[model samples]
Target: MEGWLGLLLLLVHNAAAAKMKIVEEPNSFGLNNPFLSHTNKLQPRTTPSPPSGPSHLFRLAGKCFSLVESTYKYEFCPFHNITQHEQTYRWNAYSGILGIWQEWEIENNTFTGMWMREGDACGAKNRQTKVLLVCGSSNKLEAVSEPSTCVYSMTFKTPLVCHPHSLLVYPTLNERLRRRWDEIEQSLSDELITEQGYRKLLREIFQEANYLKSTESKSEEKENQKGSKRFETLEQCSVANNELSEELKRLKSILDKNGISYKNASDKTVDHLVPSNPNAARAEERFHLRGDTGDRDDH
Candidate 1:
C-alpha cells in the first residue's frame, strides 16, 4: 500500500509538470495566448513629428557649355571651359543619383562645389570646376552660372533656409489643456515675490478669466436669442388660436340665429329643437326622416 501510494504521487507530479510545460510554450498563432498577444493590432504606427524649421530637397537638370564654345557662339564665356557638347550634371536627391562630374555642399544658403569631366583612362585632369549656389524662401530655382571657365554656379529657393519660428505646429485640444494646467500649477508653486513676477501672474490670470468670460457670454447670448425666438413663436401661435376660437364662436352664433343645428358624430348628447315656423318644422322633420335626399330638389 505504501509503494502504491508513492507511485500515484509520482504520476500526479509528472502530469502537473507536463501541463505546466505545455502552458509555458510560446503560442505561434496568438489565438489562445493572452500573454503573447497583449499588444493591440489596431494601434496606429508612431511617426516622428516634422521638424519645426524649414527644410527641403530639390532636383536640378540643365545643359552646360565650355568657355571657348560659349565665348564664340554667345559672345559670353562660361566658367567651365569643357568641350562644346559636354552635358552638365548635378546631384538629384529624389533619384538618389549623383552627378558624375560634380560634388557639392550647401550650408546656411551658401553653396560650394567642384567637378571635372571624365578623360581617357590614364590622363591627369585639372581641378578647375567650381560652383556657387544661393537660395531663398520663394522656392524658385533662381539662377545658375559658371563664374570662370569649367566652373558652375546656381541659385534656388528652399524652405529649410527659413527661420524656425515661422514654422507652425498645432497642438491637440487635450495637449493644449494639459500644457495650460501645467503652466498654472507652475505659476502657483513659484514663491518669487518680484514686481515682474506679480505683473506676469496677474496678466496670465486676467487673460484666462477674459477667455472664460467671453465664452460664457457668447453661449448666454445664443441661449437668450433662442429663448426669445421661441417665446415670440409661442405668442404668435396663441394669438392665432384665440382669433380662430373667436371666429368659431361667431359662426356658431350665426348658425343658432338661423335655426340651424350642428352635432358631431362622436358626441354622446342628442338634442332636438322644435322650429317656430311651420315650413321650417316640416323641412326639419323631412330632413330627419329622409336624410340628405330631403334637401335636394327633384328635377
Candidate 2:
C-alpha cells in the first residue's frame, strides 16, 4: 500500500513539472512571450526617417536685387512677363565645402533643382545635406535665417499679400455727372416707347382730364341745388311765422272786444294741453275740408 501511495505522488510531481516546462518554453508563434513586450512588437512604425537632403527653394529672377554670387551662375526672369525664361537655380553638390549645387531644370511653370551640403561655414562637420528648388510666381522672399548651425530657412510672402485692386481714384464732379447722364440714357433706351404707346398715353391723359372736369361740374350743381333748397325752406318758415303773428293779433283783438284776459302758459302746461284723439281727428278733417274749399275757389 505504501508503494502505491509513493507511485501516485511521483505521477503528480511529473505532471506539474511537465506543465511548468510547457509554460517556460519560448512561443514559436510569438503570440505571448514575456520577453517580447506587446507595445514594442505589436506597435507599427509610424515615424518616417529624416530627409537626407534640404527642401526646395524658389525665387524670382530679376527681382532678387540682393543676389550676389561670385562662383555660381545666376539667371532670373519675371514669371508674369515671360513664359520661356528659366526661373529655377540649383546648388552645386561638389563645389563648396559646406554645400554643393546640382543641375537646375524647369518644365512649364514648375522649376526643379538639387543641392548638397557637405558641412556648415561655422566649423560644423559634414552633414551630407541635399536641397530641392521649385519655381513659382508671385512669391516674394520676406526673410532668410539660419537658426541652427549651418542650417538655413526662408520665409516668403505671396503676391496677394497686398490688395492692388482695392486702390481707387475719386471721380470729378463732371465725370460723375457724365456717368449719371449715361445711365439715364441707357435706361431710356431700354424703356423705349413706340408711337402707338405714346398715342395711347395721350388718350388716357385726355380721358382722365375730361373725367375730372365732369366730376367738378356735378359737385358744383349739387351745391347749387342744396343752397336753393335751403333758401326755399327759409321763405316757407318766414311765411308761416307771418301767418302765426297775424293769427295772434286777430286773437288779441277778439279777446279785447270780449273783455277776456289772456295769459301765457309754461311749456310743461302747454305740453299737457295736447288734444284728445277724437279732437285731433276732427281738426285734421276740417283742415282737409278747408284745403278742398281753397282749391275750388282758385279753380
Candidate 3:
C-alpha cells in the first residue's frame, strides 16, 4: 500500500512539472521575453534594450544620404515602411518636384532630406513630409491633396499599402522619379524659348510698365552695387575743376601761338549750334535750367 502511494505521488509530480507555466507571458512567435508580465500572448515586451543599436530606434542608410544632396531640385519626402516584420523605418528625401538646392538640409539617415517646394519660404513653409506608397488597383485611398494638403502624412507597411493613393509605387516609383528628373534636366539644359518666343517675351516685358520698372529697379540696384558713382570730396572736385580750367587756358594759348583765333570756353556760345526748332531739346533745356545760374554758359 505504501509503495503504491509513493508511485502515485511521483506520477502527479511529473505531470505538474511538464505542464507548469513559469514565465507569465511570451511572444507570439514563442520567444520568452522577460519584460512582459501579462499572461496574454498578443502583447510583447517593449522595454528599451541596453546600448541601443537601431533595433531600439533605427540606423542610418547611406543610399538615402545621397538623395538629399541636391537641395534646389528636391524636397522632403519620407517613405515609411517595414522590413522583415522586425524593422520599420522611414526613407526621407526632397519631394524632387518644384524644389530648390537650398531646400535640402541633410540630417538623419536622410534617404530623403529636407523638402523645398517652389513656394516654400524659409523653414516655415517649405518643409513637406510626403507620404510614400504604391499606386495600383488593389487598394484605393483618398489623396491627401483633396481634403488636406500637408495636413497629415502616412506610414506605410509596404508600397502596396499606399498603392491606391500614391502616385508612385516603391521601386517602380524610384525609376519613374529618376526618369522624370533626367527629362527635366535635359529640357532645362536647352534654351527654354525659341528666338521668336524670346522676342515676344521681350516685347511683352518691355510693354508692361510694372515689369519694365522692376527690371529698371534691378538694373539700377546692380549698378548701385557694382558700378555706383562714388561721391568726390569737395576739395578733390575743386582741384579737378581748377586743373581743367588751367588745361583749357594752356590749350587756348597753344591755339593762339599757332595763329588760330581762339575764344575762351565761357565766351563761346552754343546757341548758334542749336537746331532752332527742337521741342525735345527745349524741354530738356527747361528741365536743366530750372536751378541753373543764367550767367553760367553751358557748352
Candidate with the greatest lDDT versus the true structure: 1
Which scores better on TM-score, 2 or 3?
A: 3
Per residue, candidate 2 scores C-alpha lDDT tens digits across 61-104 of 23431222342222222221100111223221112222332221
- Candidate 3 error regions (>4 Å): 1-91, 96-232, 235-273, 276-299
Tens-place lDDT digits, model 1, residues 86-172? 212212111110113322232222223223223122224322323333336544534445575434343434453465432221121
Q: lDDT values of the candidates?
A: 0.35, 0.33, 0.31
Question: Which residues of candidate 2, in runs, are more than 4 Å off?
Answer: 1-120, 124-139, 157-299
List TM-score per model, in order: 0.18, 0.16, 0.18
Candidate 3 lDDT, 85-173, residue by residue in tens: 11112122122122221221111212222222232232454323333333344322223231245323322222233323222112222
